[model samples]
Target: MAAKDLSTMYGLSESDPEQKLINRAGMSASDLEQIDRIMAEMGRMRQIERRIMRSSQEFMKLNETDMRALRKIISAKHAGRSVTPGELSQYLGISSASVTKMIDRLEAHGHVLRTKHPTDRRSQCVEVTEETHLAARDQVGRHHAKRFEAASRLSSEERDVVIKFLAGTSDAMESSLGSPLDDDAR
Candidate 1:
């Protein structure tokens, strides 16, 4: 097919830069459909995330920021890493001072511990206590299991499709916006 014909098939205007690239690459309708599906799935995932956040707030009695910080710290410890306030600040897109205050509160609650960094003499590391770990595991595990149980009414194929669709959506979004969970700096 001619470049113009292929671009028209993909619904790209002739003057669009993407249209020029697509014409050079010869994209398919299935590719366009896949992109559209991914975009739609992303919207659905955001709605699900919001609902989960709301449910967590109602059941856990913790604000979203606190819950997120706790979850991040727990995940870091589960991965065998000591989390730093700076890292949490970057991950949460908050100031380091705010992260320090949050850590202090968590420490007071006996949910976290602050210790000297393994290698850095000047920095301290935050770790979840065993008690906190167990509590977090039980709490989050049960909540998620219940959520999945409710979802289990769907057939296996339908569940697989949902998982794949969400995974693809997440990947596309992560590609567009850098992953907030990645610990690039300690």
Candidate 2:
């Protein structure tokens, strides 16, 4: 596999400190092969994600965090709710100061807006702009449409298999991490 592909698949870069450690760990050859296949498929999925994010960044001049913030705000607005900086901090697993900087950058770029909260004048609500929503529909949403089409084309049995596999994988990951997957932790 290409170096970048390996890195993306295993969440490692060129200077992985744990590579040697993992290599010497006791495991059967069959077990190693299974792990290899799983990483390869995960790498393929990362490529698909790269396509979507790159298109969104090119269209909106935003980074991954900015794109995520916009998506979250849009979701909240659609749900008739508002997002605050503290909530975003908790959701994104970042510090409040970092969230402030993010909010400032997005607001300056006209991607998000900060307005007074209805109940508390001292607090603010963050929301995605209409222009960003339109841009998302044109870029990232188009990518999702293609993926949905691909999924739809799968046979019922194939889809069921995929669903079960994904669900089991998600559960395994959560158990390994000792934490539940938060809805806003994407």
Candidate 3:
């Protein structure tokens, strides 16, 4: 079908900067509304994530990086892989000294353990304490697993569209920044 001509009645208010761009691009008010709705939903998701991060930090008496490291360790453990301080430093994008300090803090809090690497004598492996492992499984892990239910409810075609949209949005942001954001971190 031929696209509708919307050169004349683009609906944004005069004070809105997007008003002229919408008209020039021949976009309809409905298209703008849908974009606005998508942005609003993304904003809400970000807010929820921030809340969860803050809550997790406060409850665990740890900072954001500490929580992140713990999660990384937990994930590696679950995958039957060992995490080393050097790897943590690389993964966290920080210096080895900073990684050492963070590991010290976590160890002091009984959240993690430092052990000799089974095969590498020169390297040490980091592991979350059982207490920490169970707490994380019960808290952040449980919270994240709930998302699977939402995905499972979607039809395969719907899921594909959602995936495409998310990837496109990510690509757009990365392009605008002239670099991929955390390509390895994810």
Instruction: Encode model 2's per-residue lDDT on 57-94: one tens digit a residue.
Output: 98799888778777788888889999999889888888
Error of 1 at 20 (Å): 26
Best by TM-score: 3
Report the number of the highest-lDDT candidate.
3
Q: Candidate 1: which stretches are off by over 4 Å?
A: 1-61, 146-160, 170-186
Model 1: lDDT equals 0.71
For model 3, give the RMSD to the true fold.
6.2
Candidate 1's displacement at residue 162, Å, is 3.3
* lDDT-best of 2 and 3: 3
**Positional deviation of residue 5's Cα in model 1 after best superposition, in angstroms:** 44
TM-score of each: 0.56, 0.72, 0.86
Q: For model 3, give the 10-residue run with minimal summed lDDT.
A: 2-11
Off by over 4 Å in 3: 1-24, 183-185
Q: Model 1 reaches what TM-score against the true structure?
A: 0.56
